[model samples]
Target: DTAFPAVHWVMMGLNPTGSFTPADEAYTMGFEGREAKKEGDMRLLKERAKELGPGGIAKLYMDKLSGTFADGAGGYHSELSLSRDYGILWKYVYGTHRDYILLLTQLFYLASLFMSLYIVINFIKKDISPEAFVIMLFVLGSFFFQMIWEAGTIYSIGIYPYVFALCVLGLNAKKEGEARKEENDDVRKPGFRYGNKSGFFISAAGFIALIAVHLRYPRESVIVSVDQFLFQANDPIALSDGMEIKQSFVSDKDFSIISLKARNFEGQFNDSVYEVSLKDGNGDLIKTNEIYGKDMTDYEFTTMDFENVPGVTDYEISIKKISGENDLIFLYYDTGHTDVYPKGKMTGITGSDTADLTFEVYDKEEPGE
Candidate 1:
């Protein structure tokens, strides 16, 4: 998983020298000034060596060889014209600035991934109710603010869906708690109207609960699947470029029966495959199987009997296009929109997490079909 390496990088930032340098005398004493330096130099070397374990030393050498730093020689740096003044120079003005940037970005993504995984686990563990699941949908829907993070081009953007899903769970859970409190209170009671003190107090409580859950359990959960499809002239969200379309579902119940259906809008491609996978948060596959698409009729549901799956988070299903330049694939929407949604021209659904529903695929017919 990208997160393991990312997590290792967090330590790298705390002690940049440790990742690529050894804490041992052999490695530390070999530095440029150590041969003739004072005993104090030896002390400093020992301290640095202690901080930069063998892993750090090897990593530092690796980065140095790759030319991650301009002051450093060899490898990727040798190919570049370091003499020029540009973004690269600014990036390298400080020795370990890039590593710091990398560390921050990675930490942010790691946090999001962790949060998303937790929410997913809650769903799988039946820790959340259906109402809370709907709330998760709204939270993820609001997290489209990816445009703000590194212009929405960074790796964190990939993690936003997971974070957004969890946010939905948190926010919805809060809203429901408030609504229930309001219902119990008399309509004539003080501060019962919208935006009143009573509502505010309840809302605050819900928000606090959300935060508490986040902090109390900062552990990992399976990231069943995250799939994004932007409608391009040629590449629609469902139309694959000879790739696979995967989605994740979290189930709280262990069911012996699980099924999948993909809506295809053309002749049988004879090489389509439907796959179901059960995985952990780290993406280690637990169980997986494939169903051929050619066997099923177009626009029909094909059921597959998966083994009794353990109640867990991050169950994934994928459909592969073996050969078709432009095959009609299914697209799903959590909620319906008119103006914003492609409708008949294309099917546009709310791009958010709805844990209660099973993932489905369908073809677009008319503008809103």
Candidate 2:
């Protein structure tokens, strides 16, 4: 009776609570800055589209041309485009939505299974053998052809599952003699045969081919950097005077905040007490606060939150290695922090350094998802 907010928000906000179509998602994928967000978006779209029934998706895609999605951390990155960046997006989409789709596909598959079992039970009463039916069940449960395609995200992770389920149902209906086909093991039926044109295997193969063709895009060849870390900044944030956190890329309609990262704290040898300030080249203090730690000598990268206020110019970082490393000063501000929800709570504050930091202005959005 209880549903977690995570799934609820995903269904409501990102997926439009299943209202939007796959065509909309596939089209929206062309937006800038959508490389990461679009994965979750498309997953919701596909599942809903399937529920609505046939050709809705194909018709949607058929009506549109390839455009751009949201602006990424590095700017425009095509969706499902064969480009390197697009590949990263694909990997994410494949991994994230794979399980949900499989469960859905399994649901459909079970429907056919139940029907076949009914037919099989009647055939047995009529003195027909049920060995082939047993064998078919075994094959379906095994890690065979359909399942094999499920492993590598063969077209959106859900692709193989959906088509596979359809194939099973289609082939089952096409089974040569549903009235009494189970009578002989020596000569099975054409529709249920492994290689028959209308059989599940052949049907699945053709479906897979179509999926492959649909997924194909002109791949983009570009250099991938090896300097990626778990979390990072993708925007050159503009900090206001005394504004520790700014709303550069705010996703939440009601929540506004950004996660802060220390550029050098993780790799540094000396752990010390320091204060960071957001300012400009004029040495004026935009936002100034000292970072107090328990293990002054423990050098580790830590992330916290600061509100982004507009009109801020730059930032300043000052530190004292260890509990007493003769106060040292360091400074760095870069671009990025895609995900919503800020990290850490407010520790201490100064004049105008209220616990709740707010941005003075909101950035205007250009047309696109």
Candidate 3:
């Protein structure tokens, strides 16, 4: 079963295409400097193949397979290598900035994993049937696989039904054992069984407590600052080669930070880079900053700071894509043409003359302000 897929991946590596391959260059290139090395390896392999002729083709295939495996494994290693310094479970939980919802989800998953292991232990000690033991082992394997790989929730959808099935079987077995014990004993204890009313009430009370806590403290708003926007950018405009967007606005106050609503059309690890330039009324450059797509959160306002500029000054902001590989970055714009910033207008956006890029110009408060 696995052999067929293994052979297919090896064959795909020998003749790589943009579609199917043993290794994805984009995934591997997320790490710094790997893109250049991978490209160099490809070039060197092609040159060596030409020099060796027919004999080299065989070696080339093997070489390509080797490169694919090494690169693929290296990407995983780079991710796991960090766990050596920070423990695996710690890194997995806090690898990225996680919100309360995500944190709770991770905690739930950890709890489920531990509970599954506990159930498996009890099943083994109880000398359950071979088929039941095998099923529990499969569930344990799935749980461990998820922990080791740090797979997302979508990956567990298939295994969740099995986990639930095992839970149901374990509960039934416990109830049956209790019934037999009760039949042998004369006196009935005045305590709750595993799935009795008391258990339900306890679970309900815990759930209500969670809800009360959630209601008491709502999730924080995404926009927390009091900074003002020059114009609202409600629509998105994708930037490509030869495309430039310019916005003109008059400063209402002294501001040191300029923010643009930017979004990456690709994954967070994409290598897209964009350039933002600020020019005075006379068209002389005031400041220019380059921001990487990987550094900016998707669909959020990313800011660049500079020396404060006084109010009542006319300025123009230019935004364009500098360089990227197989990714697109979008700068948001206002489609309503409300003329919110009446002092200036937007230009160079495709298909609309009145669209203005969404931007916030403000001064950040210093500490203890």
Candidate 4:
């Protein structure tokens, strides 16, 4: 196990490797300009597809869509790949899930821009300056960069500026339209005109809301569920012989309770109860706990608390699947490359590739100086 890195690789670099290397560095090194590079990539994909067949094509598609070259192929497997212009176009029209966030942002921005243009031309009664175009580019670029800064993809907040600006403009337009309508005493006209600014703005908001409902909300819910299973905020300090993830921490404040997600495969071994133990640095037992697979029910992580852990130094915690101790299972640790050392080695344990008992240690905090 490893302590969580102070900064995530994505935070330090646009590349997950945490470097400033271009995502398509492998594809673009020999080629120049955007079109030439794209053409070269297409050629490579075709050549590979012909050689590898459909499976290779599928793998290449996943690699291209992700924008990362994790598979050693030229294609990059970045989520950013799915959020770019072409990815979004394919997604909305074809209902593909290649990129998650870019399509909606692009649609909202384009709609707002077109709506603004139409209003200025027909209703604003003022000349649209050349500076507006420059401002639009500036706004778009700034929004685009901010997404990369926060997440690796254009899925978050990149569309907020466009949505906010459009909403404001729409409201102002509606106010102007209302004033004009009242002044004309147009009793024959409908109360809400289809051509009015309010209508377009409202439509834009509704469109965004629908997209949020269909995509963003569901995706977030799944992510939250997965987060519960993994210690994401900090890195695991160790992996038990059974491959259970472990970590060590020091509590500055007095607390006796702790919890963690059970390391069971989805729907496998969920009905069995496991014995858990907490021990002090002296190898003295402090508390014993138990959890059942039925109690976990689905992917919910099980938590156990030890009363009166007291403010102490060097505590160790362990969990063991006592119900089916004899069962043997093969564990596959992904080391990216097949020949990578240590992690790529075969299981030394006879019954399980993972440690039947997992352990996490916590250092005791010293009293205030």
For model 2, how does the per-residue alpha-carbon lDDT over 161-209 read when each residue is reduced to its tens digit? 4334544544554464543457656576555644544555554675566
lDDT of 4 by residue, 107-146 (tens): 5555565555554553345533454444445555654443
Candidate 3: the clashing residue pairs are none
TM-score, per-candidate, Cα-based: 0.26, 0.23, 0.39, 0.33
Cα lDDT for residue 69, candidate 3 = 26
Candidates 2 and 4 compared: the better one by TM-score is 4
lDDT of each: 0.41, 0.34, 0.54, 0.40
Model 3 lDDT tens row, 324-348: 7744544544656554445567787
Clashes of 2: 35
What tens digits encode model 1's per-residue C-alpha lDDT throughout 101-184? 343344444444455556667788776867557756754543333211111122233435545566556556556766887789
Give the candidates in order of TM-score, highest first: 3, 4, 1, 2
Question: Which candidate's TM-score is highest?
Answer: 3
Among these predictions, the greatest lDDT belongs to: 3
Worst 10 residues of 4 by lDDT: 221-230
The clash numbers for all candidates, in the given order, read 24, 35, 0, 20
Off by over 4 Å in 4: 1-154, 161-246, 263-269, 325-369
